[model samples]
Target: MQYKTVELVIEGKTATLFLNRAESMNAMNIKMIDEITKALKEVAASSVNLLFITGKGRVFSSGGDLKTMLSSTDESMFHPVMDQIKNMIVTLYTMKAVTVSFINGAAAGLGLSLALACDYVKLEKSAKVAMNFINIGLVPDGGGHFFLKKRLGEHKAKQIIWEGKSIPANDALQLGIVDEIYEGDIEEQLTFMKTKMEARPIQAMIASKMIYSTQELQHLVETLNLETMNQLEMRNTEDHREGVAAFLEKRIPHFSGK
Candidate 1:
């Protein structure tokens, strides 16, 4: 499908989604958010066994679009953004496909949250990621608070968010935020990971992913209930049917938002 803010390429059993607004550092604006959510919904219904997310330029993402945020008068609009973001993160975690994030460079604020949401994060040695919401007089959104707290513990999470510090790839690795650091060919590394994933049973991989994710949930039943409702709502959309059919027919899915 042709998208204005993103690009989707499916090959074999892997689907790669690229943030295409390199000129803007792949920042998240309303348009970008909508496009990404749409793309993810498509991926969720596909036969793709692995999902890879990366950016087009030197930076993974510079975070939310300041211009768009500043233009919004009513704060209520922000809720939809937050909801979409939460759904995206949850979808990545619970997806039957293995999720990987290639952090080529900077990933700040919401970008950091998006990176963390992936099952595995591979960073370039020079990449820098941070939670900079406090610096901009905004609170953490896009599940930054939740993911950070879960990964880094409450105290460390508070320090990072409140201090608004940039974490280099090395430091992020030491902190267990990044799984691997690469200086050479990322495509080779991705191929290696994909091969390893493909070697495993897809159903087993999905079950393991669910077990790990659900281990931290305070109310697993409630979460599953919510997921069920969300899936039901998605099934009613044209994109859902197109996505499923495309996967079954081995063709590219075209989403029109119906």
Candidate 2:
């Protein structure tokens, strides 16, 4: 399928999905979310053994489109968007092929959540990452809370989310948020992944991924649906208004926690 906000390329056993919105730093809006859901469906039905995900241009993704979010009138607007994102997360996590996020730049908010859902993540040495939901007076949706706590444990994950911590790629690698950091071309990493895939049975990998998905991520999908409702409530708060206002105005947010 043709996509306006994303590109899908299938080469042999690997399928690379690129977020194509460089101008907005590949922000995920409703349209982009819809496009991505279609792309994932395509990937799921393909013979691809490895699904390689990346973003175009400087930043991997800036997360949600604030312009879209700020202009939204009520919870009705968020419901479909969140549902698509939630579905995208579950599909990526549970797909037959193994998934990898090649995070070449900043991955903030839901972008970070998306990467966290993947099976593996490799970041460029200069990439930046954060779960800055609290900074915007919102809870982590897209199963961010589940993935983070699963990968980093309860205390560390909650601390990062609450403190709105942004970290460098190397720090992320050390903290296990990213599996590797590379300073060279992405082709080098792709080559490494290809070699690794050739060494093992793809079916075995797929079976293991499916096992983990059913045992672990099934619960996450149910939980995130509930989390989205909580996030919708937070988005209606006075603090959320102030946070978005300060963000757009290029100033510090004076959140009253209301």
Candidate 3:
């Protein structure tokens, strides 16, 4: 399967998915979300033991596509986008492989949510991350609300979501969002982590991920089932189909919310 917004490369036990849209800061448009979900499904079907996600250029992701968001008028148009976002997070959280996010630069909104969904996150020293949904008039649509509340606690999570302030890589480390910080060469750090990860037995890694996800998330099954059903319902909308088609064709999607 070929993808436009994302590049997938599988080597031995490691599969790397790069957000290929540097021009847009790898923003979460409908197409990117579809490609990512497709990629995860592919990885799940393969012999890949570890899944690593990163972005091109300077920014990991800038969150939702502002152009799409601004163009949307009908409130119903928002449901499908939110459904996809939730599905992506839930799918990644329950993946049977060890997932790692390599945050090279800025990650905001749904971008931050995706990174946090991974089992491990590595950040460049200069990287910035924020839950920037409040900057606009929208609430956290993705699993940002769930992941942040779980990791940062309810009070701190509310503060971050409400403030929409960017936290640097070092600060993110202290906040437990980023597991490791790379100062010199990011590729070197990734290579080291890759080697370390590849050394583990694949079954053990998968089992560990399952255990942690089950234990950490009390409503894991219910959340994923609800998200899947909601996503299917959203797909029935004209806006959702248009958004997906426009994304695949590499053009700006015009969503009418019909």
Candidate 3 residue-wise lDDT, 1-258, digit = tens: 899999999988788889888999999788898888889889888888788888987888988786776565455776676666666777788888889998988899888888888988888898899987554434555577677777788898888887778999888889877788877665676688888876778688789779888886657545544544554455456766675566557886675646
lDDT of 1 by residue, 55-161 (tens): 98878899988767646534467556656766666677667788889998899988888888888888989999988765544456666766777678889988888
Better of 2 and 3 by TM-score: 2
lDDT of model 3 at residue 220? 50
In angstroms, give how far residue 12 of model 3 lies from its true place. Answer: 1.8
Cand. 1 Cα-lDDT:
0.77
Q: Which prediction has the highest lDDT against the true structure?
A: 2
Name the runs in model 2 displaced over 4 angstroms.
Answer: none
Give the residue spans of candidate 3 off by over 4 A: 215-258
Query: In candidate 3, where is summed lDDT lowest over 10 consecutive residues?
Result: 223-232
Model 2 clash count equals 0
The lowest-lDDT stretch of 10 consecutive residues in candidate 1 is 219-228
**Cα lDDT tens digits for candidate 2, 137-209:** 8988888899888889989999889988789987888887788887878778877887888898889989988
How do all models score by TM-score?
A: 0.80, 0.96, 0.82
lDDT agreement with native, every candidate: 0.77, 0.87, 0.77
Clash counts per candidate, in order, are 0, 0, 0
Task: Please give the lDDT score at residue 245 for candidate 1.
Answer: 60
